[model samples]
Target: MMSTSFLHPCLRRMLSDRGGNFGIMTAIMAPVLLGAAGLAIDYSNMALSQRQLQESTDSAALAAATALASGKVADEAAAKTLAKDFVVGQMTNYAGTASASAIRNATNVDITTSTSSTSKSYSVTVATSYRLGLTPFMNLLGHSTIDISTTSSTTSGTSQTRSALSMELVLDQSGSMGYDTNTCAQYKKNGTTCKTYVVKIDALKQASASLFDALDKADPQHTLVRTGVISYSNGLLRDWTNKVTSVSAMDWGTTKSRDYVTTLSPDGGTDATEPMQLADDTIKKNANSTDAESVAHQKKGNSKVDRFIILMTDGEMTGNSNTWNKDKDQSVRDKCDAAKTDGITLFTVAFMAPDKGKSLLQYCASPGGNYYEAETMEKLVADFESIAQTATKAATLLTN
Candidate 1:
């Protein structure tokens, strides 16, 4: 047996050793445990803040997009106001608070608008941001806050607007058409019973110029009208392609003139397929002549500011006579289909088409409103005027 004093000493030592180990363990675990808890809370808060920020930004972007779609030109003042409303509408103390700051900071807005006499549309973009407050753990980790951002865009177009209009004039020039003396006439009877005469070329130029003069002087409430001409007989004539095909496009800016009419000297073998191809090509090539407007148009399904095709022909597919071959016919049909594919409204005119070609011309135009044939100069001019007026009315109804 041990003496009481020695036993007390050993018992005391054992108790002290146990207490020391417990204290050491507690000291090591206190910071670690606290840090772990802080981390969990901080991460949770971060996630929540991020989700809310996304929602806020999304809503703000949508609001701006809606405004843009409403045809509001994204002028700077309008954009700023749009941003303000978007942010303030969603937050507490919207007009006066940090939420407002967040909203202002978040709003990155862009508005683009294009107008033709027949159509008009706009594009809007809104960007927003939100701040995530730092969690206690983050503070302890020497971080204060995190930021998040988001962006969205929308485009809208409307037709028949009073602001802008797009017009396409198609003219027919074929060699067989040269036998007439008047601007747009064909010999219906011998001199004893002759009516009137107007060569196809002369009549087209006069009608085109007159139409341009009328529309050029007319005013749309807030739109600009643009006209492009496609002169076809054998093949389509664009400035580039038509020039190469010996067709000329006079550069006319008379009365807000943009792109002018293509001049057809009547050289190609007539292929009813030409006008459709040229119209399709021009629409595809120029959504808007300018870049800023082009981007806006692209956003709206690459829609043209306004779309139109005027098919004026004197004869049928006589040249590429083979064009009527099933394969060639299909190809031409495909081109027509492509015009429809491009969302163009086609108009056809038969100045002096033979009975066979007349039927073909009628079939090629928009049913009920597009086919017109004239036998004399007076009729030809009257027909040109009628076609012009009708086309103008229809084009005026398209989006601007």
Candidate 2:
């Protein structure tokens, strides 16, 4: 205030005396220079606050959509509240400048839904604003504060759910599966003759185990996935002996194919007709059973379960005579066609099989199905793991 009263003297001194001009110019430009420097610093702070708001908004949208999609929160009102709470909670670091109530009041959460014949998807959009503090020199020009707003959105169908699955893994445990591959990595070992020689049986166990791991990762709670494994040799006989699939007996860890590959060498032939028939029928039976997993999925409003059959083999169908084997293979083909017609996706693997076995597996595989012919043990494992990843959409997880 006193400096304002002396402006005339300073101006008169600035013009009349060159010796005092530097001090006069400095006094004249000090406010402008400080305001410019403050603006530059405030710009950096504004960028950081905007980034925080955008990140919080993105996280809130994703959380809201996932909760809605996974049946955790069903209604629009609850989802919006969930989103608001999440946004306010995530931006606690920014609360040093703005109160939680201010952030909550500045945020707007909205949701929209899209439903087709089979699936429903929910999208959440979150828009939030943060008031950033400006420097005192800038504020003196009537620019007290600035408001920055950011918005983000996400959809729930692909983001949250893997689409419920009911899969029957029909695997071959015939004598030929006991033969060794070139490379040896031992899950089962001999005293010192070195390794157990990395047989096809061992490879099947590892591959099927990897498939289990993938499915588990995708559906950790076991609410959306129902998997059954059926191993066969010579007929409907599961020569591995310890496992069976039913509504009451669905334990993936206990009945895992990985733990049950020791009896393949003694099992004589590969007759997939009866086992293929059983696999297809089991899927239908479970879907219709009131006590089955479909009932539990229904309670969660995910009753539309997709069906899959993963058929694997090391040799073609065999029987009493060579001619009879062709008829048995025909029956297996019939089962494949019927299963596909019933909306069951079929993935087939021929593990170093001869031409006939490969041809059968290729034919059994649905159109647009994943069919693999793996010569090495590693390829076999990769193929099974790929099938599980593709089916469960494990590669594209978003907050699930």
Residue 288 miss distance in model 1 (angstroms)? 12
Poorest stretch of ten by lDDT in candidate 1: 250-259
User: Candidate 1 — number of clashing residue pairs?
Assistant: 32
- For all predicted structures, in order, the TM-scores are 0.45, 0.56
Q: On residues 286-399, what C-alpha lDDT tens digit does candidate 2 reach at each position?
A: 435474646655765664667788999988888533333787788889989988877788999999888888998999997775888899988998998899887887323444
Per-residue CA lDDT of candidate 1, range 334-389, in tens?
67667766666666667766665676666666666766777665666666567556
Off by over 4 Å in 1: 1-160, 181-197, 219-223, 236-264, 284-304, 320-330, 395-400
Clashes of each: 32, 0
